[model samples]
Target: MLPGNVMEIMASPSSLFSAYASFSGSMMLVRTMVNDIIPRPVQAYLWQAIRRLFKANPPVQEHLTLVVEEYFHGQNEIFDAAEIYLRSKIDANTDRLKISKSSDEGVLVSFAKDETILDTFDGVELKWKFVTVTTRRQRRVSYDEGEESQEQYFELSFDKKHKDKIIGSYVPFVIEKSSELKGKEKVLKMFTFGGYGRSWSSVDLQHPSTFDTLAMEPEQKKAVMNDLDRFLGRREFYKRVGRAWKRGYLLHGPPGTGKSSLVAAMANYLKFNVYDLQLSNIRSDSQLRELLLETGNSSILVIEDIDCSIDLPERSAPTQKDPRSELTLSGLLNFIDGLWSSCGDERIIVFTTNHVEKLDPALLRPGRMDMHIHMSYCMYHSFKLLAANYLGIPDTDDENHCHRRVFTEIKGLLAKTQVTPAEVAEELMKSEDPHVALDGLVKLLKQKKRETPADGKLETVEEIEDQLKEKVKIE
Candidate 1:
């Protein structure tokens, strides 16, 4: 029959409904039977083919993903900086936060794992996801030893079209910002070595010494301060000169002449950490190099009593050996002025000695020790400072008769004999009373004067060396 006639016959009310129900049931039965009879592989192939035939094409888009692993090349500096920058951007959008304690910066706040944040820079959209993956490893045992290790990474996605801008401009900007934040938030830490050939230990530095409180001659103090200021401010200048952005200082004086105190003052002035290197503890040149490499930039590397620390041989004496130390004089010189010294920037190396004349002349060369500071005995101006520091004598009160008389007497005694600033400070600290302290200091000065030689002159370097040798022998 013709299609129109057949449809009209079937359109009768009762027949049409029954015919439609029967057709639907028959199709469902056929579908179930076919599905049961077909092998899984054949079904899957058919389904995939159907999907490919009907599926529409996706929109045209390009994406680039950059992954920053937590530990790259065994150092976390770049990763940490990236985390700091990404966390700051993510913090505003993410509700979940992770808080942790840090030894250097105290409390730290970051984004929680699996949190995704959207950010935009330079008209390009970027997405950052804080992801942490836990991996379980099996160990050899009867019982299953599930060792779970966590790995953290930041996945950054941006449009491929803006890849160059993102890599060249945005990333560098983030690093610079991170450095600025670190400079503002992080506290300076002082590191020191303990025991023989052990790793460095650190603590929060809390020294309160400063140039103002330091008892020294006014001119000398000013010069030291100026040199420090210049060194700190000349990062670009050092680079222009093709130098290592480092400065060396040679502080020479007798014992108890405020060398250590001066180092503390320098640390405080620059807000830099002090790495008090004990060369005796270091066993070899390799260990020393490792320590220097590990030290952060903008730190002071101090070697106190360098003369006594090791047998630093003269340049001419290459065969001389120190049985107590394996590190040679050449190795030390290399540590100071060699290729490895360029590993860090904005560094200050200070070598203090009680007997500078006995030191190797190579160490005193111009390039090795840039500034040779002579921390001499207490002078008139230094005594005045010590008095003011201990007894609260105002520098402007020159008109006070008692103060003037005490100052004149102290100056005369200081001229007649040479006593260390430490001795004068110790005497001034004997009493809290201003007059008593000043009078006690004067008495100590007179005692020192009487003990001076018949010529009333300061001890020569030879005499001081002889006394040191005798003292060492007695000890």
Candidate 2:
């Protein structure tokens, strides 16, 4: 009747539960009023009076007429069930409902679109209801000064879910909360609609950026290409390996060696976003873990110039630092290898350093640095690669006469000249005429030879590589 005057019927918890009582006393009382409480003579007289009133007011009679069905009948099943769940908040069949744990509780209900319930009494049951859900309750604070006549206690309590957990039109994963007091293990995943997040397993490997384009020499290029293919293939094959799904690479080489370019190539090849993590961006190791957790998958986490970015304490140094600058070496170590690393994969860790020797050994241990790639200087092969790349003329097995002659002269000079491929590429850009640059290059090599005397005054491919290797190594 007019939604049954909800304030009176539901304001009290006891009154609300009365409707669902299996052996309902109120039902019996209603029946008793119909059968015994009203005498036959008095009921007949009352019925006559009601009949006269209904004849006088047909509209009121029409409004009052309802299909008298079972206890739960002709009601909006979803809405009524939800309302009962809200106020009474109990599942009568549950053993826990028999034993009151606290003042408040919650319940979870599962239902099907079409069930046996429709066949019997409106297709719903007392069991299909919300019990007092046991969730972590957060206490909110309210403060007012000088006005003292309220229930002015120290704290106020409310359900955590009441405070808009489902943000920005996103629904939360419907998972059960733990009953225990300690922190619960949660499969918490954050997702934004149509945002750019990807899985690393889907990274494309056929792109030119997948390896250092500057690499040359049949054996060297083959190894570099194979190593890269094997790396990507192996990762794809074993997507979820070991406890941690992380893959680490250590790129070590002299400055100007294409280490950074290799990283850019990797990101471009994979189409993975490059998360260039500056050591300065992270204040401490714990913060580092948070950023790692927040970072999208299908991305590379780079710590460039690892040896020089942060003042990494030596392995034997104090493990813990004062609270002020609490990002100690141990905390970083724990994250890199401990339980935290197992959080997620779909990511790669790349550490580039010109001073690999200066890095702590612990940081470079086998599993710590999964792959070690050394980016070295221009060999005769790499020189030809630069020649072809910049000059747009084939240097090896060349049918082009001009390119072949320049390549031959340059190959001879490479024996005596210790210029970088970076330098060679630079010089090639100065003149559009490859032959003219080749002549100038030969003259420049002679000038360099006179001014910076050849280390041991002779020339051979192996000797040039060794001498240049020594110079590059020292540099």
Candidate 3:
């Protein structure tokens, strides 16, 4: 062993310890001096200043934030689309998520406020932050201030160089993707006027009706479906012809004839939201216009029992008050086909009435009520459908089935009398067994026939003869 080297190594430990002690003493002295000589606030300010000088600020070229607000006018489609689009980006690594479910819809998962979601598009890294800001407002009604309102937005951060790409390509991509995603898991919403402001409140639409289950005449059902298809595909045609991209339907029929059920079927087939606008709750024409504006695109606005919903006095009648503010037929007609109808696109307005003959000529015109669907009484065909739907009886043209004898008798009764599909459905629903249901329905038909007055008969002798002759011709 080298004596000199050993001594140096032993001395180095003491030197290093002394240096560390000196450094600790110096730090303690500086801290004590700061406490004694400087005010606490001043020391804090100095400390912040030092942090500001050294804290890393992202380069200008690397930072850009695009904000998407929850609403600007009415409800913003972009905000909604973004919300749906973001659902696909959620992953196990996500720190926080919000989960909600409607009574009839699948569980919906979304990113929570202040949660960050990272995504990559075209090799560009994108960061999304859900931000919520709350502000207090004064309750002017009580002359006091204690209410808090919240506004939410999404902050999309990416490199500054990709701004054009994000706007031109990525944003549109999001909208398109959202539409596809929405189509896959459509949860129809039914909105009604309620709550404090008379605004629309929505719940999951659990309607089980569809075209197949609707017991309308085959010809009429086909016509309605065809009309809807034409209307949906003619958006550009409407634009070229300078027409508002909307359609109006007037469903007129007696009670229990499935007017409301048809509306539900249409909504289900189109995958559109249903907005039941109660004109009775509406006070003024302006209010109706505002409510219409609040509705989303691809929605069916139904005003059931329109003939009795409101009193549409003749336009010639003089008004003591300002009629502009009142809910008048003129205002409704204007919103139906006039300039206000152009406010939205891909909309359908349905008006249901028990008396088609009672509606004003202006209200029943071609443009206002484009299609007039007469939901007539149940025919032999509709009875067969009800039998099939309720009793699991297969709808068959073959007359050799065991229930054929009962169906034949029911058909004869239907031909001679008027019975609503709803009534037949109720009778059919009484028994799960097809034979029992058919027999009970036959008894009801006989009772109804025996009670029918001579004047109340559905067909005259001449009409019956004509139908017989037409049937012979077909045969």
Candidate 4:
């Protein structure tokens, strides 16, 4: 049945291809391939082979293939060295350094089993030793797969000792990434120390698809990608730019704007873990410090809904504790770059809030929150993302009369409507099929537009900034 479908597609003229000519596309009977209809194990091998031929990045395979080959050679060399080391141990009679005890509570040693031979100190053979010693073999239990298995070896022991020898012990510790290990490589290790953070667990992030499930407009998507490239940074080049080994990013916009999902994608792109810091969990500065210290290096520490976590000290109600001061601001500052802020191994700290301007100025300073990313509403391009994500159309960058009309309405609606990607996604999910829902959004917008009055003018930023200065005076 699958072969027949492929045969039909191949046999059919790119005949039904006119609509796609304008870079327009269609929802298809086959989102994937005929072989994809087969069992996964067989498909896995075929997909593996396909990746060799056509990877997302062609250079990756070429370099990766060479790297694997090099690793194989290096492993062989290590095995050969091990073989030589084993032969040397069997062939050489390495001098044994042995210790023995004496009657005076001082230790005695011997070139021979008899202590008189090598016990001489300061050119005098001391016969003051009043104790005798005996040596015996120490055996440990061993497991054998079969009766024919080779014999077990024994360690030397004193005749009187009954139990096995205690092995030397040392404190168990986790080594933080060292500067030497990072070297000139652009990748720096992210380390958090002396902070209130999870010592054993850091938040995990899902990978980002190269493409958003929702289609984006070509120009808008390009702009977003370019902006993100500069802000989120490239894997290989960020450190050379004199930026901090760690960066603080602010993601702010209306609710349900896909900020959380974008974070997941960013982590997937960077292969970073997420350390989701909760302000409520941090009642004291020290607890915050500890939590920060415990997070894994190469992580994205996120404080979602940051604006609501604590009102700006000024806006906060009067209390015994000064709400005007972030009870933990000093601690947060230390984690940022204060003298106490040890540059952690390369990490990105993300703070998401609907209200960014309300944040404390010191907290938002250049070095503190290095990047401010506005995850704005679903623009025309962003609509494409939604369409693609829900509709699975690969978005041939199409702009038909219906598509154009609907997207234009969405853009206008977005200008006034505080709809979130999550909200739109919810709508898409409510219907059994997305293509039909995409059409429904157009009708919904028209009805909403008529019901709502035209967007009345609002105060401009300069006006609001001036008004805020007068209306909301700070002490």
Tens-digit lDDT track of model 3 for 306-374: 888888767778888887678888888889988899988899999999987788999887888888777
Off by over 4 Å in 1: 1-178, 182-186, 195-199, 313-325, 453-475
Q: lDDT by residue for model 1 over 181-277, one digit each (tens)?
A: 7776655568886533224556667666689888776766777888888888989988998889888999888788899999989997888888999
The whole-model C-alpha lDDT of candidate 2 against the native structure comes to 0.51
Off by over 4 Å in 3: 1-74, 93-170, 452-475
Which one wins by lDDT: 1 or 2?
1
> Measured by TM-score, how close is model 4 to the native structure?
0.48
lDDT (Cα, tens digit) per residue for candidate 2, span 1-475: 4465787777778876767794687788887888777778988899888888778645421111112111121112233222222223323433332221212223323322211111111221112222221122232354322221111001111223422432211112111111121122111122111111111111112224334455434454454445545555665555555546566788876677677667766665555556666665456566666556655555677778988877756546655555335455666677677887766555678899987888888787766676666666556787766666766767557456756665676677777665555666677777878777667767766675566534555445686445443432100
Clashes in each model (backbone N, CA, C under 3 Å)?
Answer: 0, 8, 0, 27
How far out, in Å, is residue 160 in model 4?
Answer: 19
- TM-score of candidate 3 to 2 decimals: 0.73
Question: How far out, in Å, is residue 205 in model 4?
Answer: 4.1
Ranking by lDDT: 3, 1, 2, 4
Question: Among all windows of ten consecutive residues in candidate 1, which has the lowest summed lDDT?
Answer: 466-475
In order, candidate lDDTs are 0.77, 0.51, 0.82, 0.49
For candidate 1, the per-residue lDDT at 259 reads 92
RMSD of 1: 10.1
Models 1 onward score TM values of: 0.62, 0.50, 0.73, 0.48
